[model samples]
Target chain A: MPASAPWSAAVGQGGGVLRSVDIGALELEAGGELPTVTLAFECWGVLNAAGTNAVLIQHALTGSTHVSRGDSEEDGWWEGLVGPGEVIDTDKYFVVAANMLGGCYGTTGPSSIAADGAPYGSRFPLVTIRDSVVAEARLADRLGITSWHAVIGGSMGGARALEWAVTFPERVRRCAVVASCAASTAEQIAFSQAQVLAIRQDPHFAGGDYYDGAAPTSGLGLARRIAHITYRSETEMEQRFGRAAQDGENPLHLGRLRPVVGGSFAGRYQVESYLDHQARKLVSRFDANSYIVITEALMSHDVTRGRGTLTQALTRTEGVQFLVAAVSSDRLYFPSQSQELAAALPGDVKVHNIDSAIGHDGFLTEVGTVGDLLRESFFAQ
Target chain B: MPASAPWSAAVGQGGGVLRSVDIGALELEAGGELPTVTLAFECWGVLNAAGTNAVLIQHALTGSTHVSRGDSEEDGWWEGLVGPGEVIDTDKYFVVAANMLGGCYGTTGPSSIAADGAPYGSRFPLVTIRDSVVAEARLADRLGITSWHAVIGGSMGGARALEWAVTFPERVRRCAVVASCAASTAEQIAFSQAQVLAIRQDPHFAGGDYYDGAAPTSGLGLARRIAHITYRSETEMEQRFGRAAQDGENPLHLGRLRPVVGGSFAGRYQVESYLDHQARKLVSRFDANSYIVITEALMSHDVTRGRGTLTQALTRTEGVQFLVAAVSSDRLYFPSQSQELAAALPGDVKVHNIDSAIGHDGFLTEVGTVGDLLRESFFAQ
Candidate 1:
């Protein structure tokens, strides 16, 4: 294969050329066989002769492979954290990001067509964090990269990065886990369960097989609304929206006095309106089944599953350097969880603070701070 | 009116005999008329001469007038806190608990028969915290209680108590607002909006007019699941449920490999089971329309709504003794918000802490501590 393949015209912007390579059928963690698995990925910079300068950047739930404005004008979620002259400088290192296995962004997911040429939909088996890491290792092998200098991600992405270090300790030299934990806490599982039920209970969901219909947009939107609240901090929500009414809409008097069947009241508070907007955006861009698939996979995230204690689970990663960080205001992935993850690691790793008020999403929004931390720790020139 | 009418036998575990008095028509704050409002209440102990010893205890959202197991074997939600020999000392203080106006507990609510002889359903107007207070004040008038010696409540109950202090300053001699804020924060409104949406989206809900058909149990259950999470702290949930799987159920292998339309995977985690249990309990006992109405009322719980500022809104309560307390582990109603409320009070009020690891529900669970605080402050012999 050539050093770089032509960009696939499937999805995403010019962060890098979107490409896919079939990783073949594999047994899933839960039980069932995915006859064929196609992993979609994007890359920037060139792999060095030694192939030792490679870095894998994992994306969070609902995140695409686009990491920066590489060849495309569209800014990535972590726009300033990568690319030329950036902290994870493409000029000095070959950076790659892959769409997670149970995702919709050009990856083999619930929305992807199966061997029978029908959308997998609810037929897709449960994909765990370990399974995704296994698939990514194959992608790395196909790309001629024997080892990665570092694997970095935050939130669900952070879980993926941590899984990579644990599952392939010999392959990842360094790993950075930000705003994530070794396992999903009960609260995390509870929140995700609510999201899943919201979609399932949607009239249009039709189980997870609604791809051929109207696509449970309402359910998906409600799920996003619930998830968006978790992604943000209470103080941030209070300060930004407060109890102010949405402009020109008196939540007080907008609804019908005698509401008819299938009719409901409009959101009166600015916060409600804000949540509605967030819900709408996610509903439009993402696929509902993909959301459920990825969310459940995250809910099943336990680095210690079947592996004794957290310390025992992380025993294999002794060879990999670690960077564990947490957002100060994050309620979803509490900072204390980061401390727990760091404490169980092999070395005396210190948990770093992101010093952000943006909550769990701080890992993505605070690009300057994230870049600064990366430069000082892993990519120091 | 008789000292105590026959027990209405409508709802609630026996405390005081549940009795209803038609307060007549009520003009609601949100631009609607509620024709013939019937306020349901239960009282323990006889009213003292001059009615100076009457203490009104407001129930929280979904809570009934059963503040104690008075005349029945069934226990009340706040059973130990208010009884013949308890903190409030029902034997000495004529303690009364009223089911809030948009409540399902024999109160004039969405499920109640309207003037037209049909269930109100969706035609029920939005009842604010102040409106409930007004209706309760009328109940007090019918019972010949000139002024309440003290008015106490927690959570949404606390909001009602605070509103009483502000809306009818002279009527309440002392007010205790526990586990609540002066106004509903933006985050509170956002969470509530999701809940309302959850119920509204239920196909069987039929726009809140489903009283004639199947109840929106699924939607109501989802709403309860969402609310139940907020009612407890993350630490409590983590310590209690963790990621342990439910017995006899492998969340991993329970779902259909090829999921059919409308099918869903069973909850695998103990936390999910806990939430489901909570949902089932609420769905069995509560009305979905009542849940929406009461939740919206709580969402509209700003004491400063029409009033200038929080301080200005609370300016009328100068003569009313204030006891502002917060659950130390509460994420739903933060201690800082309690502090804010205390700081704005006329006197140098100190916010008390109901220190418990149980989170927001600590106000209910830590009854011993709460009773102690009440005895030391308001009900001291």
Candidate 2:
């Protein structure tokens, strides 16, 4: 048996508790050994007598395990969709959300202390989507969830949901992969690679070993700015910011003459201000090494890596009911990619369209539409 | 008359001569003055007694004045389209190409010497499309060309070409604006802003005055990488590079352990290698400050700025014939934008489409299609 340790459970007002479980050493897909993998998770409601009513919700890159506000009064990322009387109906179904490996939210990531008492830092092993799912399965085993009633996620979270179903087909009854593809496309990888380079290029980065020094906030901010552009659609930007200068600031001659670093000239365009705000927010809460780690993991996400063709890779998932969805304006993961994933599935799976001008983030923003789909398909009585 | 000086013209074998002409001190639209404005230009064929046969060609951002292999044995960018018997027919219409203001290729830009005998560097004034056209007009005066048979260009060059006709309606008899728009969209500005930030964040950038020290090659490379992604279509990137690792470079386990800067792991993806090559090439030949200057100029590309609507902006060009074209797969400047431009013109200018899978670069790559349009319309004499 794997060495297991159950840490303190911080119970919240809604009976949701945040917990961490040690799954011991894990051998990564590519190479290297993670001596001890600790997964931090949060759960709501109780398991049924048969222990088959459990549902796993995967979080996207840079997301934490706080899927909904349970103990904490702070609003969760997906608060409305997973509440007591909401679509997922937390009171009825046992819900579990885990901060993915390589994340900094109480998980055993690069920032986590190693056996030798130093932070893993640059020494952290390369982890893939499959590896994270494997770690999640260990957590599932400890919780006595033999088979999940459903698994759902969007964006990189959607990728994890699909991986769970494919890696352990018998463990998942139904899977909803929203606004994601079966694999990371070339364009997707290209964008992710650029982000990685942005952080690594920062002099303060110091080969990811800057735990005691000044954080690479500038590089992280730059990376966030780049990613934020991809998350939203062109039409949305055009409608919202449309070449308008930021209030009380002119991005013209005087602005150009000023240096950008500490000067007020950076926020010339309203769109630049929006991007700057996004970058600042992410830098404040997120870790740069975690960003790079998760980004690289997402880059290594191809469900068909060693499993032949996409059809062949998904052959094991014949028993799983699938819900594939795409945002209409998502330039990152195009709708056609979702169609390709659906077409490659074992059975006749139809791709649900979430009509949104918000681009890739629509899966997260269009909660009403997503909740409706989940209620009608996976959670209906 | 402008205080003009004809610098020595370097005549190439194909009879193309590279020359610089002083257009004197000029007032800028953005509250500054360029004490002395010199424009670098190149010419092919010969001017007739009428001088109306002179056809002005505008180059895009980072593009040089060498439109064809004239005296230079090196292959010009648009070599096949403008030789003795080609589409533009240099032999028939005295073809002249000028490197715009704020360019590095022998033109007065940020790298040029100021009145104090030092590089303009960060002190370079903000220049707009109208400003460049005004400077080009003085060059036209020196060449004794009263009217241009046609002013043609693509991408940023297209913006310059359109500005010429609108700014000096009677000087240009015909104009072709290809793969461009009347204004830079919000998304375009967002992307350009990210690139500008990337350069400024570089430790070596030193507020755009790094001429005496190591140049911001890394930051410039990052900027180029960002811009290059926007230049190509997603389908093309997928078809060409599709998750394929570079030869002998595994982007998996071992690659992840390696650091990015000066590390072999950076070129794991074939697409990354391609981008790296592109960045390297641009860094070798182009100045970082020039890139920023031209980019900002493009960002300030609203023809309807001081002018009323787009229709009002083109009101002065009622006498000039217009040819508007768009790349079918262009995502940067959408075809709809080209249609909007064509619709706002005085005449019924049909938006001709250059069907190609290459995306925004199609305007430059699909020479045959562009040449066909020019031959049929602007150069059909």
Please compute DockQ, using alpha carbons, for every candidate against the native two-chain complex.
0.63, 0.69
Model 2: per-residue lDDT, tens digit, B39-93?
A: 9998887666666777888999889998888877777777788878899886777
User: Model 2, range A319-368, lDDT digits (tens) per residue?
Assistant: 99999999999999999999999999998999999999999989889988
Candidate number achieving the greatest TM-score relative to the actual structure = 2
In model 1, what is the error at residue B379, expressed in angstroms?
1.0
Candidate 1, residue A286: the lDDT equals 97
- All candidates: CA RMSD (Å): 3.1, 2.5
**Docking verdict class for candidate 2:** medium
Model 1: CA > 4 A from native: A2-15, A254-264, B2-15, B254-264
Residue A277 displacement (Å), model 1: 0.3
Candidate 2: segments with Cα more than 4 A from true spot: A1-17, A260-267, B1-17, B260-267
Residue-level lDDT of model 1, residues A226-262, one tens digit each, is 9999999999999999999888777677263344353
